[model samples]
Target: MPESIGPRDEGDTEPVRLPDGNLEHLDATVRQLLDQSAEQARQLDNLASAPAGSPFAGFPPGPAMPAPAPAPRPILELEGEEFESEVDTLTDWVETFLMDTYGDEVSTAAPWCLQWQEHEDVLAWLHALWLAYHQHKEPDAGLAGMAVWHRDFLTHTMAAVRAPGGSLSACMTDPDRPAHRILPGPQRSARRTGASTPDTGEAPA
Candidate 1:
């Protein structure tokens, strides 16, 4: 099995080169996770701040028009500590690898090590990783490998947020907000219904 890796970046406000190889990809992935986390935090804040009956109050509409409304916020809350633990665990492995591979110079931050505790990128990765891991069940054939793959993919995907010169944000954004995932025809985000409206018996085109 290939060693699972996440994003790593030089700690400068700009970019720094690790004494070993560059972990730019890993850094971007971690940064993305942080962004998503921040967004989640913002989402939670929005939900918490909204008046009892605003448009964003209930869950937004789902694919099926009659389906249960979307919750304005996630019910199962993930606090900062739980999120950071996973990130920290991943970072620890990277740090250990660096120490073993390059020694004391490895003191540099792996995007997860924060100058400040509440970095949004770290939080986003946590939320994304949590959702991807918890929501998707194993496929038939009882495939056990995907979970690890999923975690690693997310780790790198989320970390790409700090690619030294490229649009790290655009790159990281692709996984979560895919450019071409939207299917053609009918409704954009979801499948359009061919069913009739309640008031009128005629089917809506």
Candidate 2:
């Protein structure tokens, strides 16, 4: 302890009373704090410089605070490298957690695609589901968060993706032979033009 601020003898229980309005008392308190701080710094320096295996040696440092959680990812809006990076992360989550855990038996009824990422519709649905998974898995999502996800989100999506005649119905029905195909979208036909001879024959009829 510094002589400037250490406790006095047994009889000196109370500090010397200073008048409230006095600047001298304030100056004294400040000087006392500075002296104590300097003494502490010196002690710390000495302890740090002490020989190995001293009582204070190898004292554990304070625990570091955990980093703040990252911002929520924006979905379906990324481009180029950013898009690809997000897809990579999504692929890992889908393969590791989604497919390994909840994957149903693959058959003509419950179709599964090996090349699901190539299908735009399947990609969009999975990405959306992936985003939702992250959201609900966080501490802030409450106790029943995962339950809500499974019921409201996962069940319906899996059904839609794997149902008979769904998007992946034509793909990967058998494990031994893999197949991938993007079903063509609906198209309208061009109107037919009537020939002059056809118009004359119609008039004659």
Candidate 3:
């Protein structure tokens, strides 16, 4: 009770005595903290000096990306004799297909018509139609393919070729004479029988 210790002031940083081992431990701890602080400062400096949009400013770079591939081309671009050969082949196949599929309907539906295989314009149109239609002619399409051929392809083609002033009509007068009328169908047969029977002639006994 002879002397009393007072509380330390806020600004007090006076050195305290310690054992030799304790002093060495304190020195090593201070050096480690200083080293950690220096490393943090170095990283901050690098970030501040880095250029705009640099991935290294905040994170490391990753792997590079690959380029895209090119698109495919179509198969209907033959030239010269090759084009003629292709058209001929396609026209033959289509004509056979139509005859085998809907010969009777075509024979009556559009009686006065061009031989589509011989007519370049008709062949071209039909060939394109066949190419487009065949793409969807898998086994699953079944009767739907034939239905579409008749309803969409055949209907449009017959109309275009048989209309009064259509491609077939134009072909009738072509200098090359590539097209001709198909006869002996139901409509023509009826007309012929009617014409042969005279109005004033008496009935046979």
Considering every candidate listed, which one attains the maximal TM-score?
Answer: 2
Q: How well is each residue in 17-38 modelled by candidate 2, as lDDT tens digits?
A: 7677687878999999999998
RMSD per candidate (Å) reads: 36.0, 17.3, 19.4
What is the lDDT for 103 in model 1? 27
Q: Give the count of colliding residue pairs in each prediction.
A: 27, 0, 0
Error of 2 at 153 (Å): 0.6
Candidate 1 TM-score over all chains jointly: 0.24
Q: On residues 33-109, what C-alpha lDDT tens digit does candidate 1 reach at each position?
A: 99999878777877787788788753433476577865422212445876456556545643454225422221112
lDDT of 3 at 89: 71
Query: TM-scores of all models?
Result: 0.24, 0.58, 0.37
Which 10 consecutive positions of candidate 3 have the poorest summed lDDT? Answer: 104-113
Error of 1 at 49 (Å): 45
Indicate whether candidate 2 or candidate 3 has the larger TM-score: 2
Segments in model 2 whose C-alpha atoms lie over 4 Å from true places: 1-75, 188-205
Displacement of the residue 12 alpha carbon in candidate 1, Å: 99
